[model samples]
Target: MMCETSDGDPGTDGGAAEAGADTGGDDVDEAGLAQFSALLEDSTEDLYDNAPCGYLSTLMDGRIAKVNSTLLDWLGYTGTQLVGRKRFSDLLTVGGKLYHETHFAPLLAMQGQVSGIALELKCADGSRLPVLVTSVVKTGSDGQPLLVRTTLFEAGDRRAYESELLRARKEAERARADAEAARKTAETERARLHQVVVILQKSLLPPELPQVPGLQAAAYYHPASTDQLGGDFYDLFALGDGSWSFFLGDVCGKGPEAASVTSLIRYTLRAACLHADGPAEALDMLNTALYARYTGNDPRYCTVVAGTLTPRDGTFDITVASGGHPPALLLRADGTTDFVRTPGGMLVGITSRPDFITSTTTLAPGDTLLLYTDGLTEARTTAGPRYSEEALHAFAHSLAPAGARQTVTALTGLLEGFGNGLDDDTALLALGVPAADGVGVT
Candidate 1:
């Protein structure tokens, strides 16, 4: 398609000659052709120099023939520094140069054109400019290689955004790892505390049960939680005389404070008994000592039964003094079970000489005495029914003729059967009668 002036002038020698037919016709034709060629050259040069993106021409060997103003300003270089003297590869970073040789150049040669490649161009000031470049081979009519034309685009903002994103991701991962490590550390510390609670809890009980001559004694203690240090305690110790003192009691609460009072009661019992004569005298001493030790606004008291089982030839003399404790159960060889009821006693450590009632009983052959904390008779039932004293007595009756070891095992099993319902601590001490002529457990 040809575009000419509507008047039919086409920057042609014919039009000029027609007009010049009246004047300098030969000279006008020559001048018009020269001006037209010069204008064509100038317009082509200006389009190449001022293109929006980069424009370059490289020989098949990658030498730069021409470059545009946009890319020249982008690299902070002039045409003198780039054209003819420098190859396109000279503008690439060290890594970019290596990549061009290993993959880019080979790929371009095989595929004839490579477009929109990410690269870094080095400036004369020793700084780098990130860019996306494209190149193509200007093949001739027969498809022979001629020159390489390339375009370049700036990429500073994209690089900055990606760098920030990577930084944020790394920070998030670090925080997640730190949180996991903290969780594991806390769990480890809790386990250690549980272990300490277990040790401290065991410390509240006797190291070993006392050996009663001519009698077989066994005791069981079950803590509700390894995490909680219990207030329940039991002690089996020999008195100054030929008698032995035993007690099983529970504080009003559980945990560290109750544990402290439990320890006090144990030590006080031993000390008070050492300073006294019989079970009744021991209770009197304990009452006085405890009231003097811990009777205040915030009271610390316990339910206890201090008793003695003294061996008298072919029999055992038993004396029990109660301080708000449950009655003791006596299982006989005749399969008769009875409760030695002791009422009207107050909790120890509350008042001075709390009227601790004293009672007496005789232990003959095949008779078993059981002393326990309320954790037994007060155990919660699955039906939410309370385990009454009568129910415990009935259970003992069913378990008649059971020796000390068997009775303690059965009681511990019962305590466990309460499961999560057994919120309190339980301690039981069973002393079997004389062990059937000292043969063994019956």
Candidate 2:
């Protein structure tokens, strides 16, 4: 397009020159051309000097040849201080210099380029600048290396992020380790406590039933929990006279306090049976001892059936005393069962003077007498009700003619069958006379 002058003349020298310049012809304006060339030169130089990222050109041997103002400003250096005076590795920290020589230089020489190499640069003030750098070998047209062009981006934010992430991970690992140690410690303590409970529980009962000359005796004990102490206890020991003293009882509660009471009862009964005249008198003595010892608002009491077994001709005379305890079951060889009842016996240790009662029964050959704590009759059962005394009597009736050992074994099976339904401690003692053929099981 040709420009017309303001007076509409197309042939004027000034208008012709303006049109030639706009169209890139020979008659262009030298002043306008000079101004355009200057502006383009300044812009190109400004772009390189003040780029967002640092830029530098280094010789093949790493000596600094040219560096942009952006990079020089970052290092607080003048162009005269670095250009031709320093090498690329000299601008790096000591570790960074070693890495540049060993890893970066070798990789770049082989690959012709390296990207995203993280390094630290030494600042003029003895501080450090973390950077991610990339470099390329600028080659001549003949394929010979000329110089290395490098760009660097500051990496302080990224470094800070990585450090924070590492710290959090370490803390999480430490917390898990601490929790595992605590759990293991708790488990060890629990196991130790359980062992102590087992030992203490054994000390409360007879180690084994003694062998009575003519009578076959058997006993069983079951605890509701492995870790807790049970209140029920049984003991069969000699009176040192011609007779034997035996007792099965349950204290009012469970644990160490109840165990203490159980121990007291066993010892007190043994002593009382030896000195007192009969089973009833022995129970009365026990009541006196307990009442004298425990006399506060927090009174400890127990239900007990204690007895003396004195052997006679072809049989044993069993004189039993009850103190608020369940009646003993008598199973005979004649396929019959009965309860030796003492109806008005009071709970031992509740008053200054409490009443106890006596019941006498003869255990002939093929007769078994069973004494038990209330844990048996009060146990929960699959039938959806508490196993009452009536059920126990019926169960015993089914096992008539069974010996002491057989009876105890059967009842132990029954207790196990209750599983979680049986939540209380139980104690069982069975005494039987042999048949004519000496066929008592135990």
Candidate 3:
């Protein structure tokens, strides 16, 4: 049974169905495009409101024309409260406001744009926020400035870092100043101690050598270090009956204790010379005194050479005594040198009975006798060998017949040349008899 369709034949209905499908596809495309457009518009407005950085726009008169939701949220103010009701500078701190008027505004006017300006913004809660700002002036079609668009970023962390750096710098400067002051104080104290040492050492030495008639006398003393007193001592003084007494000695060790022993020895020798008959007797007395005073756990000792001189017919008779001391060097009128031997003598202040030895020599015209401590002979050379008595003998033998002053000067130069090699105190005493014509005695 063939049923007739209400409107069209089979072929016509097929064609209509195809047309309806095409129209439906067009409508779907249109609807999709409209929805996409609405979505794009919504996204643009949301992005502007919730941007990561704050944004604001101000009119040419500085009145706020527009502000993003992000900026309003950061400042704890609603958009309605800021736009058209306040200016951009009104939302800044007092100092920031002044800076905006004086520097930021003028620079923007001149340059039409300013970037990376540091400023502080005031919040509704009265707190401040450090921020870096950038702004550009938007011009109208006529090239006239209409509005200013600005962007801001928080600078709290950067500000904190700079403040810490400043604090560290100030602390370092204070430390350096304190260290310098301490160093200066130490130097001042050292200077004061040096002065005291100098005065003390000078007191331990003879002020001047005694003058002898018809004879020339000279002496020199050198200390190894200036910080402490040396133990070497010497003195020349008249005894009685035209006889003069002299002595050179070196006490053990150095500093205040050794200085005390030196003082005692000097006074004892001088006192002994007053009552003793000869050089040997004077030394014996000194040995007895020193041994009695220094004994027990802390034992002290010294080496000494004592002498007495008397003027004879056109010559001088001298007697020298030794207590464990080096032999005296005698420079003869014939330009020869010899050590006056004193054997088997013992050190003073070591035992109750120390053997002292005596030797006698006659100082004739152009004859000089030199007495010294071990500091000279024991001085080390560059080769690490000592300037022994043998070398000294050779030195004295080479000198042309000279008197006390000239001999002392030559020896002083020698000592100075020794430099750091001379590590001990040296005491020198030279006595010479004048020639008949007084040729070389000065």
Candidate 4:
């Protein structure tokens, strides 16, 4: 025997004729089915009002016909406010309204079903709510379009997360830019410090050597590095009444202390010559001052050559006082060169009474004299060869009869020719008579 359940599929047979049990079975089954149908109707109405997502329906004219409680609550509206009063586009944000008009409505009409698209809805409080919507066309049995149904899901959390990430990335980029700007500012400060040091170094030397009458004079000072101050200097200044005083010297080391010593030597030489005529007397005064001022603990010394020139009776008279410096070069008008040696002088500031030497020469109209520090002649060559003094003398001999400008220019070119081997600061001073009274040698 089979009896029927409420939905009309037989569970157990109601009629038990085989066992003689057919009485009162039909009436009981009918009553139970009526109760089941009423329960199903109530559940359907509850599902329509309190669905997990939102629901909406529009008439054929695109007017709102129905909306669920969930959607109405999000929009801050009642059933009367939505139905027949507002369309789906009225709930969109400005951007959402543009998208609905240009793309969403056309796409829904063509495809008949559009699913799971992002949008923003305008709430009654004038705030925007992010959502995902799916819409489909509804049709009657006669194949006539009657309404459109749409589902909505809240997407506020996802939109907020994406916005926060963009803000963080923008902040990180600004921090990186600020760091780069600070690095460049630090570099700029370093350059300014270096420039200050360079200016201080220049103050230790003469701005320009005075122009000695009837003499072609030129000089050069090559710094070991732009960042470091060296102690090499030379100057040519007038010593009253037709004679000029000049010097070339290098102090013991580089930096501020050496620059101090350099300035001391220059001023001391000038002051000493105010009371003397001979080269030996001037250098003697410099040596005594240096030895007295510098203690032996961190002793300071310098190699120097002090010379004077005076125009006398058809030729120029020249005198030199040497203190452990190289000999001078004389280039004659007839292309001959020789070293005027003064080799017996002791290094200045070494002892209280170190020996000094003096030499004398006469320069005719077309002669040149060259003086230099040790940096030029001591550089290494390509084959690891030190440029000997003999080689330099020979090089000058080959370019004899050249005046001050030409001589220093040629030497600068030679130093450059050594390429990477010029490892020290070079100082040069040269003097010669220009072509006398337009008597051209060429």
Candidate 5:
């Protein structure tokens, strides 16, 4: 008799069996959920302990409260050793510890977070590990600081790269310093060589112009280049027995070789004048000497104008000779100018037998004679044409009544005006006789 209550059915045994089956199904479902929850917990713990980077948690006073397995492995310490006894800064090297205390801690205290701080850590085996660290301060609900959570990344390769960069920068600095030293040495040597060239160039020219009794004379020399010696030279000296001799010449090239030839020619001319009777003979002797000295394939030559002046009772007897040189200008006291031409003269030292022409004139009272090198005529104007011989003639005519000093001063100013157009060096010599009325006219 399975009893029935109010509104009862007659299958009580079957209903009880059904209720038991429902309870078993609920138990099975609950067991599956519990298994899944346990698995998820285990995975979360594994992820935190064995992550790619290091992790640690510290109390407010910096004592290590928790440490992951990965951090313990990098520092070569057991969890028990670090979690209970060590602080976070204890894993850093001496320098890193000092930096953390002075800068990193203060910055973190003010900002509540610090990231990407470069630091070096100390390992248990007495080695260093370069790392970049980031840290955040965990706060309670009331905004009170509670603990610090930190993450570290390995930076061995980055440290090596920075060291290499520093080495390269040092090498570049040394190279720059060496180059500057070499440049200064070169400049000093250049200055010394320039001084030597200047001394040699001065030796080739006359020390001073000789004073003639009845003549007022002036001379000037202009060098084209400041660094190298030039080939132009001039000299005026007494040749004994009421006779005065003067010569002006230009050689072919410049520098030490040209300077040597210039010296030889000047001395030869002075020696020849001591023995020769007239200007033409003296020039002939100079031509013979130069031709004999340079008889090789590289022949040396020059253009020369030699002259002699002899005072005769308030008037002077002047004989001029030309060796392929420009014609001399004669300026009269009456404000007229003419060229004392010596055509058909050959360049000296070109051939063993060269032709030289001679011209004679009496430098009466208030007369002037002017001689110059080809640099004056060959100079270029701003319009690109040469300052021709005709132009020089006209210029001399314009200064007809100028004295030697005045004429030279005016011509020098003209040369200055030419600027860079005067490419070659110039030599000028001017001689003038005073008027009988004590007037100084060219």
Candidate 6:
């Protein structure tokens, strides 16, 4: 049975209940939205006061208008203490104030904004706080500037990092300067030591060859390095018996140790000449002295060509004794050359009874005898084989009919041509008998 109520239908009460449910849902939604809007409104002021960074506003005349709690806390100031009483520059330290007035203000005026300026603010407690500041101008409706809005970020860590980089740069520069100073000092010391070596080396050799009567004598010495003391040496001095004694030799090594051996050899040879019978005896005495003096692990030895010159009526008698030295060259007037070789001689100073062979030759009119250290024969000619003894013999043959001075001069030019290839010290001694016309003929 369909029953009609006062609204005339039986489902009228159910429809009224559903409509009430819809009204309740709408009211709940409105209430939630209202609550959310209220919360957002409440957070606006809180967000400004307790923001992560500092914020402030200043009047166009630079006077502080308002400052957030964050800024006040960082600067140790109160709202009442700073607002309307102090300018923005008053919060800055001395240098910051200068920069703000001279640079920041003018730039902001021209561009209407400034950003990322590093500055220091003086706190109320006298400590300075580093900050990176950014600022912009707030304008009115007519585009006229009203106030300045500025933001400050803490810059302590960044400032410290920059300071460390600067310190490191300065330290590197100091280290480089110290290194340059040390290098210069070392160079100066090397120069001084080279000078001393030069003086000491000169002392080891004869100042000049003594004058030989009736015979022309010439010599040359070249050291491979300016600083090293060369072991090659030569000398011509008059003996007490009217004959002259001359020697050309090379010690085992270089430097002061070899120089000491060379000094001993020179003095021993000169002293032995007074009592020794001949050139061979003089070398024997030298061998005995060397063997006795250096019999240890550091044995010293030398190769020598020692000889006596006895003047004849128109020539000189040459008696040369060799102790493992290269044979002397005899350049004759007839454009011929011969080696006065002593094949069986041993090196001096190594044996108690060393063998020394003697070779006799005469320096007749327009003839020359050339004596040299092995540095000459061992030199390189053109980056190929060594300048062998055979080549030198041929070379001397080409310079035959040459006198002492001319041959020596030509050989000097040859040695110079070797340049850096002559790695050893060289010594040359030439003895010649002049032609009857009295000029040294080349």
Local accuracy of candidate 4 as per-residue lDDT tens digits, 83-174: 99998998998889899989999998898888888999999889888999898888889987788888899888888988999999899999
Candidate 4 RMSD computed on C-alpha atoms after optimal superposition onto the true structure: 10.5
TM-score per prediction, in order, is: 0.67, 0.72, 0.72, 0.60, 0.77, 0.78
Judge candidate 4 at residue 313 and give its lDDT: 63
**Which pairs of residues clash in candidate 5, taking residues 3 or more apart in a chain or in different chains?**
none
lDDT of each: 0.79, 0.87, 0.85, 0.80, 0.85, 0.87
Off by over 4 Å in 4: 1-202, 378-395, 412-424, 435-442
Q: Which whole-number lDDT from 0 to 100 does residue 235 have in model 1?
A: 86
Model 6, position 21, has a per-residue lDDT of: 71
Candidate 1 residues 1-442, lDDT tens each?
0011133324456654455675564666677756654554434456556766677788999889878787888778899988889998988999999989998899889998787788888988899988877777778899899887787778888778878999999999999999999999999998998999988888888878867777788988887777788888878888757878888788888788888888888888778777776666776676676677676666778888888878898678888888889999998777789998787977887787567778889888778889988877777899898788899899889887677877888888888889987777788988877545442274
Model 2 — which ten-residue stretch has the worst lDDT?
A: 1-10
RMSD of each candidate relative to the true structure: 10.0, 9.1, 12.5, 10.5, 12.0, 11.5
- Comparing 2 with 3 on lDDT, the higher-scoring candidate is 2
The sequence of per-residue lDDT tens digits that candidate 5 reaches over residues 1-442 is 0111134432354554464476674565665645544544444456667888888888989999887888788889999988869888999999999999999999989998999999999999999999999989889999999988888888989999999999999899899899899999988988988888778877888877877898989888887777888899888899888889988989999888899899999999999988998878998999999999899987899999999999999878999999999888888888889998899988989999988889999888778888889888999999999998899889988887767877788889988889999889999998888888754543
Those runs of model 3 whose alpha carbons end farther than 4 Å from true positions after fitting are: 1-172, 380-387, 394-398, 436-442
Pairs with steric clashes in candidate 4: 1-13, 2-12, 2-13, 2-14, 3-12, 3-13
Clash pairs, model 3 backbone: none
For model 2 the local lDDT of residue 350 reads 86
Better of 3 and 4 by TM-score: 3
**Alpha-carbon shift of residue 304 in model 5 (angstroms):** 1.4
Give the Cα-based TM-score of candidate 6 against the true structure: 0.78
lDDT for 338 in candidate 6 is 95
lDDT over C-alpha atoms for residue 80 of model 4: 96
Report the CA-based lDDT of candidate 1 relative to the real structure. Answer: 0.79
